[model samples]
Target: MFLKSVFLVYSLLVLRVYAANIMGLSPFKMSVIQPLLSSSKNSQIDCDHHSVKSSKRWDVVDMLKAMAKIDSTVGYEYEVMHWLRDVLEEQGMTVEMQLVEDEHQSVTGLARHNIYAYMGKTRDTSIVVSSHIDTNPEGNIPYHEIGEEIHVRGACDAKGPAAGQIVAFFELWDASIIKEGDVSLLFVIGEEYNGIGMKTAVESLNATWSKAAIFGEPTENKLSKGHKGNFRFDVEAWGKKSHSGYPELGFSAIEFYLRKANTLLNAELPYSPVLGPTTVNIGTIHGGVAANIIPDYVKAEMYIRVADDIEKVKAYVEELFNTEHSQMTIVQYLKPQYLSFDVPGFELIACAYATDIPYFESIDVKKYLYGPGSISVAHTQAEFVTVTDLYDSVIGYKNLITYNL
Candidate 1:
């Protein structure tokens, strides 16, 4: 029969394109993520739990529900970065901490900190505000097929832009119009696992390169200026365990690590002008050793994202894994996806997503990147963020540092 009626109309057109990607996250992208997952502890959104900040748009919705009940997640961000450095040292500003670690996430290589606060440094360019208080334990893994609903877990990809960059860092230094030693504030932690607390905070606080470095996440504020830099690795592949009915003396390493990541993902990159072009994401893959045997040794982990000649896109991914898997080998090459901060006149954004600006794309910063919820309601279980976009991003970070210092 016409190829089983053309594979039953191509499996009902792949089940109607996976039910339109689950109706595009439904009209409920943020109806207040299920009443903030019902945590009202006895209901009181307006009934008067001190009527949440009583006004000023209900005190920016009770300060974004007290900074999403502070659960920084990822290897637990030092008690929400010491409750946001005790609310930036209760405004007087002048906090500093950097513990760094020996491994990362817990072999003892963790305990990150870079809570800086400044007020006067006049000019000579310098601005380095960053973000990544981590969160992504995913939880709720009931597995579904492509309807795109990967619920909860740093919901909008960054605690709703770290609760609109901590109310735009106290509406930019408590309205004193951010004093300006060119400006600085960087909070980071494993950026969800492998930024290794912003690479041990720019090599242990020789923080340097600061003419610009704004890198907060929840983007809806509209000034990300640019993103697209990462280059993780790991792809073994050997093979020789045998059994499964003599499969050519065994050899599969996840089928030669998916044919060397589908040949550099079918090649073609190099482009940017507004941080465009470049991306890849195999994410993970490991070896096997069961179901009738025949495994050998596999390993895979991929991540790519760079715009404009990332060393010719990493030498075209090592010449497409040395010509599509000649038994593969690159065990872990990292360090090729940069962005280590960049700024000069400021106002630039493209961030396809991923921050700590590729660990400061080489420094020299003047960074700019506004914040304040609507990353479509981060960490949804009804996660929230609209105390009027956290007091309009604390009056739009005090009018973007009083219109850029």
Candidate 2:
């Protein structure tokens, strides 16, 4: 037992020396020694720590975990915004809130606010790091840890990038590298929906002088050169209601909708060499009151990921819906956006998803989209972002800020 104890002590001494070399700490320092000796008995010491002493640096994982705990789905972003505002204020940054009126106030009964933080008054040449603060409502599930990956609703879709941006901003602030009004962080809401938060911010903030903007979205750590635009509409078919048993007495709205939707699905959509072909999704369909009654009014919401000019696609859709019995209403239309970046050591790729880039087009700033995580799992139940990816994104964002500055 005594020999075993001696061997254990020797191993610990060797590890302590290695940790001191890596962490650049004095091995004999009391702060280091006390923690090392008590670490065996202390539950506070994490097994993976280089030594018993806890690092004072801000942890991206901890911050992400904190942010993930708050439910920030669409219209329900008040709690997360409050938490972010407090954290930014504690970091000595000037924080401001842009109140966004909820269009569904009668249904949700919740107010929405966009949070913006910066060191000083905005400057004309400032660099902006931005990301959405909300996740898809369907995926607001609890976060869980699996190995080095964190599984959560918004872990990859946005919250991960948001946390990374915050950490990068904090690091820049700590290093005194960025002056007041040199760099800013903008966390907007409702990107998962119609981008109302960004639209509100652009008009209200009047930040046209900003030279560059770095948007955070899941790109698996690569930079996005361009992304597809979005166009949404609902096709509603109306017909006379009749008993299901009656064959030719009344037209079936469901049949009419199916024929139109099939025609659209089979039609050759405009294709782009970079963004590929325009895609359509029959997201939701509703019509009949019962199985026994014919559906008098049938409606199907369709979303098109447009790869061509938005107007061209809109015109094509209108042409497709020109039938006398059918009608289409435009829901949302955002033009395809192209981004540019000169950051070294990163591969550039194209994204098929839409972002808030369209809303910021009025500012005339060079925009770049980059972040950790993959888009494949963004809105899925198994959404996740690796710890390494999250940590690396902090450096990525910092590099972007440094380059812009």
Candidate 3:
């Protein structure tokens, strides 16, 4: 106990030095700063100690609503990232806007960034709380409240959980339950599409020694057991074009593409009892120029949620699509990802969606997935999360951090 107390004091002194660097103060000046966890600033605080006073507060629902109003679709996440950086800076945390354009080409011609932040400017942290800030482009709804529920794009998918994480960090800091270098926050873009944002972060972030990480996604406030893998491909075919009247003279590209698609729809794919069945989705199709004209080109995009081995799924797809009339191109592929859910009292769930967790497979960290809301309504026009869920998730995240630390 004596050694532990001595180490705690040493850690606080080191944190003060790092804080001085971030606040542009000399080490001597930072040392003279008021006591930690002053009750005068936050009279509402319930921590054990009491000292000075301050007035700074944050809310999960407000943060969620603010982010939901912004359109941070896959390729256009600069504005949302900027907003989060400002919020983190306001809390006196050291923030780094890690550029992600080099990894994935931005469609908006604007720079993309991943927010990497830590209190007191300490690069190394024991725990990391991360979530994506991007949403699908189809439903970019503005912030609006429907009674106890808040309806908006990215509200349930991730922004709500991200907001909860931010608030949880603040509460922990305020109560002095967690101090400098104990935890870090990372919010990345491009998760709805290719996961380029997190891919970039795992390659360059300074937290190599982190022991555990919590990823925020829609899990209905339960701890995720694992999630299905992904295998996406595009099928393209070409045929001669002619007028509708000359039916015999031209070939129908759409018809040919549909035949190939039917072959896949009827094929039997692998499944597992734990992760469930592998699912397929024919996402998009584009080919015809006009109703009267026979189409010269056709293309169909397909995605698979692989519950079985991704290699086996990929091999089956490759052999099935091998033909002269059509060409198949693989877009994205990832194996199923399993996560740690040993925390007692939390319900366990397996998701059918893919996340950025696979990108960190090589890292040795206890990865966990937990957040508020349901994935069923995430990408739809009905996307939303309740105010109760948002508040619950703040506590959920705080529990996970406290347990891990």
Candidate 4:
């Protein structure tokens, strides 16, 4: 135990000194790295303290575990951003924090930041690797290993991919494979919610930073050829409220909402030969104050996976849900995104989930989606990724970056 603590403390000190010397920052006065080092009791020496001297297969496992332990759900990505900034800076990379505050914060009341890093001071690069630093709103699950599989919230969804990307950058830097402004790493926030972080990045950052981009998501180590788009909307029904004993005097909002919801759900939607049939999910429904009283208002939140054109899907919904006593308000929508798998030797598949891919449409760069773990178990209590898969992705990401370079 003592030896491990000594190693942990020593690694941080060495990194602090190296970062200070490289970035011209003040020498070691306790930074964000200290908190992570002290909190991560099981953290291993993934990289050499002085320099990147090792590229062990399981180096990312400990790091991923530590990152998964941090609760960076949706609006709460500030701490994770700070930790990633410190790590990147310590590795002699230039880091910046882009605040993603806008009108949305009035409701969430929490401001989040995105971490962007690159070699040297220049922002221009030939290749870029990116991933979301935030997970779903589900509370943080304790990190634990069950045989080769590790169970933890955000393990498969993104933190696992994020950790792999970080290590891949380190490996590339250590081997001198990439130089100043050769590549950039972008970790965005709010991908699980509204994709505001990515929008802000695209709007604020230099669009010409890179010619190619590698986006990390849970693709089961496969390179995605395409992924379905999405549209979110809410259905609200209003009715007269009255006592249940005299039900004839009042109309039930819940009953009206159910009827509309059922009709809309039963309607046939668009389909695609490659992306499959358009699907809809009634994610949430809330109404009624008590069983004895008729509910005056009811709302149902719905999400649609767009396998076909986004406009067609919207038209179908708007046409089908037209009614007198109900209102259908569109919340958010993203067109189905397609990408190239031109790089040889990778398995290709289509994903149903939406990512921040579409937001970069204006960049005019070749986009590739690749990562470790399975999306099948991403948001559930059983969310997990195997140590083997996580480590393999580290090498995979390094190779992808090499290809772009």
CA lDDT, every prediction? 0.54, 0.80, 0.82, 0.79
Writing each residue's lDDT as its tens digit, candidate 3 over 1-405 gives: 999999988888887776444332345643434344423532322121122122345567656765666678888787678767866886778999999894346667888999999988687899989999989887567656789889888988899999999999999999999999899999998888888889889998756646889999999999999999988889888888999899689988888888878887888888878789999999999999999998889998999999988898888878766666778898778789888998888999999998889988988899999999999989898999999999999999999999988
* 1-405: candidate 2 lDDT, tens digit per residue: 999999999987877776554333455531334243223532222222312333244478766766776678887787678768866776677888888875365146777888888876653337888999899877556657889999988898798999999999889878999888788888999888788889988888755445789999999999898899989888988887888899478888888889888888998888889888889999999998888888788888899999887787788789877577789998778999888868898878899999999987877778999999999988888899999999999999999889888
TM-score of candidate 4 against the unseen true structure: 0.84
Instruction: Mark the regions of model 3 whose C-alpha exceeds 4 Å error after superposition.
Output: 1-55, 102-105, 244-248
Write down the TM-score for model 1. Answer: 0.33
Question: RMSD in Å for candidate 2, one decimal?
Answer: 7.8
Residue runs of model 4 more than 4 Å from their true location after superposition = 1-58, 102-109
Flag regions of model 2 displaced more than 4 Å: 1-57, 102-106, 123-125
Candidate 2 yields a Cα-based lDDT of: 0.80
Model 2 residue 238 CA deviation in Å: 1.2
Top model number, lDDT: 3
Output the lDDT of residue 337, model 2: 87
